[model samples]
Target: MGSLRFISSPFSATIQDLGREALAYYAIPASGALDKKSLQLANKILGNPLHAPCIEFSFTPGKIEFESATTICLTGADMQFKVNDKIIKLNSIVGIKSGDILSGSWPKLNARCYLAVKAKLDLPNIYASYSSYPNAKIGYNSGANLKKGDQIHWKEIPLNVSLENIKVDDKPFCESIKIKKAPEYHLYSKDITDQLIANEFSIDSNSNRMGARLLEKIIGDKFPELKASVPVLPGFIQLTPSGTLIVILQDGHTTGGYPRIAYIPENELSAFNQNAPRKKFKFKLV
Candidate 1:
């Protein structure tokens, strides 16, 4: 048994799994990793379950130390990191021992990353999830952000588990995210729709797990009232009354007051998280 301790970090980091499903009826959010694929790859590298407790970090100056032997994997944002003075590769597994220090810095180009260990974090689960839901404070770690001197203990696993290298597509999500027109897509004028699909927008500072607000605003005629609220998924795109377009993320609200406009495909939902604050993205309506 070992304890994982955080020595330093610049951004709020939390423990997240695949997320709690079928609980939205109680107004719970299905908050989990924004990059599900990367999380899966990390767990796979250490032979852990696809949906295991993993650490997800925001902007970093991330540093951690372990007090026992454990195998771990890193994926998603390619922050510059070194384990014991040796630079390690993303999407690869690395072994560590007691008092081993791992540290990293967030680069200019990426926004998030995942670090999955062979064993699960001993966290209190809420609504069948081990994820930190900041809005609800469901996870016991209180938004799950690790602070200086905080300790994270992992559940015991067999010591003989093996590690393996995993090959990942160089940039599986490089292309523009695919979208399907929503029920109210036709409400906006042709000029609005044209601008929506062809123009590039930057993620704004207002972004969080709940949703991303884009920098570019729709300039055409104002959209008419959308009648009533409707169910919205993680990728739901809605144009606000003032023309602000927001892209929903993993911690997004289950229903939206604005008119739904587009949705990222389910298979590619996790890939979109790479479009972090100030990052630009174009869209194509399928």
Candidate 2:
């Protein structure tokens, strides 16, 4: 068996794959990697399954120590990973030897990064998935975020072998996020709806995996309200009574009582999730 130990962990580090399926009936959120594109790319570079479990490091992964030799790849935000004193390029296959130390600084452009190893992570298969749902204490390490002194085990892969490095693009995330009218889009007045599509919104600092709250407010003291809770998924934009707009994310609740003003396309959710706090963006209505 092979393993990696965290010397110093990031603010939010969790084991995530594509997420669980057919569990929404029980209100289980689809807790997966926020940047799905980067996660898949990292796995692909390591010649692993597209949905292989990876460590989703948010903000940055301070440092890690390799307990066994293995090949790995990093994707998403550029944290400038380094092995010992040598810098490692992102999105390229690199081999690690026992006692090698990996470290990275805070990411500059995006919010999260993915590290995929060539072997399967020895995590619990809850709901047939390795994704962590921390609210319910559901995955590896009892669904707790990784911290210093923590180690993760994985099946051993061949060592001391040459691996082909894959060429990946510098910028993989989308530049603009597009949204479509939701079921309750007509509930708001034309003026409010226009502001939503025309004005730009900045991400709130309080935002987390559950949702991305926008800093701007469209409605005043009063707005149309949903009579009852409705099924919501990732990317559903909900307008709260406080006039704040929040886009539901991968770990957001299954049902919401707020007005679903607009919905982001599944393909665009990755781009939206990568937007850092206070990052300004305009939604293009399709």
Candidate 3:
């Protein structure tokens, strides 16, 4: 077994896999990598299972040191990772040796980064997932976010295994995010609905894995609340009583009382998750 030690942790870091599924019946939140596609791509480069565990770094994963030889790949946000002053390209396998140091800064493009190591992380699974859900104290390090000086042990990949180095172009940022009419779409008038599609929205700074809060108040008038809290899922966009829009994400509540005005498509959820705070975009109704 080898280990990777965080010399200095990122703004927020967590060990995550694909997250728990079908456990909502128990009121459990499916807290997983916000950018699911990135997580899968990173693992793919390392020849690991698509749903293998990876370190999800937010803002910046300041510094990390390899305690032994291993292989790794990075995907998602362009954190501009480097080793010994050499830039390490994303989506490509990079070999790590003992005492090697890796570092990165705040991403210039997306909100998060995924690092996949060619090894099995020694973390206990909660509800059949290695994903972290800090709110409920489930996952790595007892559901605590990673911090500086933390060490993660793992079983290294065998030397005989062949590693492939792959490269993929970074996706361009699209200002228009696609959405579909929700169950409560009838609650609003044509004018209000038209205004929503016509106006642009900015992601709020307070947004997190739980939800992405849009800055615009498309619904200018107060609306009656839902009769009861309805079941919600990732991509469900809830219109608040105050006129704000909140898009439920991976860690969002399974139920909400706000009006479900529209929802992003399942395939586009990862793209929307990459939208950093203050980024502006329009809703492309489909």
TM-score of each: 0.93, 0.94, 0.94
lDDT pick, better of 1 and 2: 2
* lDDT, residue 68, candidate 3: 90
Model 3 alpha-carbon miss at residue 133, Å: 0.5
lDDT of 2 by residue, 1-286 (tens): 8999999867888999999888888999888889898898888777788898999988879789999998888888888889999999988888899999999988767888999999978889998889988889899888888899989999966533333555566674444689999999988888888988888887898888888899998966579887899999999999998889999998889999998999998888888887777767888989
Candidate 2 residue-wise lDDT at 128 = 82
Candidate 1 per-residue lDDT, tens place, 80-196, comes to 878879898887768787888889886566677888887867888887888888887777467756677878888766545444445676463444777899878987788888988
Give me the candidate number with maximum lDDT: 2
Report lDDT (Cα) of residue 277, candidate 1: 71
After superposition of all CA atoms, the RMSD between model 2 and the true structure is 2.0
Error of 2 at 256 (Å): 0.8
| lDDT digits (tens) for residues 1-286 of candidate 3 | 9998988867888988888999887778888888888999888777888999999987788789999988898999988999758999988778888999999988776888899999988998888899988778898787787988889999987633343454565783567899999999888888878978999888898887788898878766666588899999899999888888899988889999898999998778888888777788888998
Model 2: CA > 4 A from native: 159-167, 173-175, 219-221
